[model samples]
Target: MTQPPPPPPPNQPPPGYGYPQGGPNPYAQQPPYGSPAYGYPQQPQPAYPPPGPPQPPTPKGKLNAQAVIIVSAVAAIALIIGGGVWYSSTKDGRADAKSGDKNSTAGTTGGTGDSGGTGGGSGADKAPANTASKVLFQLPQPAIGADGNSATVDGSWLTDTVYAKSGFAEIVGYDPVKGTKLWTVPLPGPVCEASRHTTADHRTAIVYEPAMPTKDKPSHGCSQVAAIDLDAGKELWTRTVKSGDQAITLNNVTVSANTVAVGSTNGGAAFDISGKVLWAPKPTDTCYDAGYGGGEKLVAVRKCGAYGSRQLKIQTIDPVSGKVLSEYAMAKGIESASIVSTNPLVVAADVNYSAGDGSGISDFFSIDNKTGQLRTKISAPGDKYAAKCEGITKIEYCTKVVVGNDRLYLPTESHDGTGEYSKTNEIVAFDLATGKLDGQRADAGDGYTISPLTMDDGNVIAYKSPPYDKGGQVVSIDGGSFAQTKLMENPATKAVREVEFDMQPESAELIYADGRLYMSQVFADKPSTPGASDYLAIAYGTS
Candidate 1:
């Protein structure tokens, strides 16, 4: 094409500049005949529509230069805000992954595979209200076979013992908040069993008995009872009792303000803190289950008759002096009975036989602690199969009975016709004062054989051992409505074994002192390499 009038000079404005100061004309009318329009020259039509809708006329108070500056500043601020939101979302995702909670959904905290619930906080912020009452502490190791025998939580310190390869047990004190070992006390022998009992004021007493000898040798004797200083971890005093000629089986031991009671193959015994014998019951054929009541009386159960058709003799003895304050002879008709006492009341259970097919029966009872008198005998409303108990090898049929402050919690296992332990679930709470069933019966034994329940402030903390599973779960039952809460999952290991590879699991003994739930476990597993003695400690309030 003929060089279109040679393009205007590159650096200078196009020809026909009409305005001064090199500015475009403010008022210029276009000439006819296909020429540029008024005020400016005509450009080619745009290939696309205008970027946006036409702007409205500027307001009277608006400033053109300052407005441009403000608009740019507002745009910058919006971009900064948007970038921050994006960064925060990315950071939260990374944090969840780092916490080993990859499965957690956005906006949710803890779930089945997560350590915390949706409401869980990182540090000490009050946990989300929906979280299962948090596990204050979960011992990394199991309790059984471990050197750490008994554990008790007093204030912030958790005191326990672990066994050494040298056949001795080492006592350890741990801080629940920091998970640090506070102190340790070395013992002379391996601990067979250990328990932590508390007084009303929250003081802790740890009792440990040495393991029994093998079947080849006769039993050594009962475990020595010792009260250790909670702060010093030193023995306050040690007393040895000959519970029986055979190896003693310690069921449960409890301590009050001034007295400590130890249960063994023989009946239980109560002693003062100074190692003086307060009261020792004569050995009876039936195993004795004992608990202390307010440092004043010892509540115990004695056998009175044959297995399957046996009787229970409930007695309350004075702690200050070795004297039986009151005794009640429960007849043989009752199926199972236990001593559950808080203060003014002591509750017991009695199973009565009915005429129809042995399945028709009424099984329940309660007693007053002050008078050792029967309070109420209501017909336990449930089928026999659902209201039975386990852990009674000698006795054909039995039900576990547990006592709490306001109610009595019972778990019963019924066997199939073939005499094998079958799945039967039933938990009944009897009102301590009125002897009436509190709310409705809770079904805890279903698909599992529930053990004798434990309590902390009327809450039931017990194990549910099911078939095919080596271990059991720790469940918590609330007192207000008899609701159930699965507090923690039991590890996959048998609690008792000659040589366990995996750490054994144990249930928590709920202790509410300063608004925290304290739990302890004994871990007993063979050392992976030689030369390591098994160890155990009490872990409470997991972070």
Candidate 2:
């Protein structure tokens, strides 16, 4: 059964009921084809049946009243039916338009215009292909001696040249862009570690710690903190650091423009460039974790108490005064924490809580450096990546998470499916401000694992290696979309087998600055005698 249209709203006409006393309908004139008028392509007009001959005139005499009334009723019903069809079609068109808008916002698959494939198309997720330049230069092997550690070198990128800890007694500099030796400076002892930092004037300085002596070589016992001016190619200052009566063996060195932080086993100290002691380790803190300094502030972690029930504290200090400006204690169950970044500080650690699936989880926290307040906390996925990696040598795999430039990247391990325990490292990025996970995860293909080395210019450089494979390749992951791309390959490293030793591959000591990657290939295979592998700093272009 058909029903008449409903009445309109108060003071409004019914749908399609209003009409003007006009000569023609507004919609009657559509553009013609290929012409501005009628708006349709112009074609030869089609022939229609010729108009019928003029109808005979009706009789002018008085007509029957019943016939007139029936004709008028039929006309009104026809107008109402026509108007109903037009109104329904218009409403449907509007609904379709709204649906399209929502899909665009939610992210559509197979969308047009170069959108990334894995997650929703984001402009930032575009892969950085063809950004690496040709291999600039290959570093020569370091000179060797009777001691095995004498030939090992660790390299870091400075402003223009590559600074390296060469043979225990000297720092070597190389011209990466020009493929030439820059300068070399003699040290008091073998340099076991080196870190390059910038001063207030942007001059480069290499802060280093000498190697500890073995029982066989008592003469090499060294506990000195020294600095070398990379630009001037000379030693700036050197001083013996002592804790009580024993020499302090530094674990790492963190540097800023005006201050240098020397991290040790139980405590650490901060000093100025001119060998002035600015601060020393406090007695309350026990073991000190890694520290990082930048943008006029330094942040670090300190832990105390027993291993089972320990407390981890975060401290931010004024780089110039060495005063602890702010300190905050992490929530309970935070097993351990690493300072992933200093500027707009972020930390990554495991929260010892069981999930709904009965697995485990990890989280990254963004902290306010000034107020010691936690800003945001983002939870990680349960892909067996948050498992405790005790004794893992690769810092990127175990500790060196990164947060910067609007993204927080963590190296996570995933099952390879070939064996019950076989896994490899992959990078997962999150929103730094909100701690939301991006849908995509960056990988370095099968049989190869990726370890993050540095992040710059919306890209992250990772060292990619295969188990029991020699050498490694440098790859880049787009921070925005998590797309992976290969940048460079090095064929110098030797295959390190885990079957025999049951140890993770030793990390390739490396650092990046000014669009270049500097690596000290200590385990690389040498062409000559057995167990006499050559080592040197190799520089590669990243952007």
What does candidate 1 score in Cα RMSD to the true structure? 37.3
Worst window of 10 by summed lDDT in candidate 2: 70-79
Count of backbone clashes for each model? 32, 16
lDDT of 1 by residue, 508-540 (tens): 122222223333323233444566443332322
| Per-model CA lDDT versus the true structure | 0.36, 0.43
Residue range with the least summed lDDT across 10 consecutive positions in model 1: 70-79
Report the lDDT tens digits of candidate 2 across residue range 1-543: 999767443322113323222233211221111221110011111111112111222356321110000000000000000000011112101100011111111111111111010011122322334544334565655543443422223334344333433433566656657656778777544443344334533232332335423446523332455555555565655544444445554444545655656554435565565555555544333344333433335766655443334466777876655556777788643444645556667665656533222122366678888888887887764453432221100111122345556677765654453432333556777777677767667765544566665555667766664433433455667767667676554443332221111112232345444444454442222335666433344455544
Root-mean-square deviation (CA) per prediction? 37.3, 34.8
Best by TM-score: 2
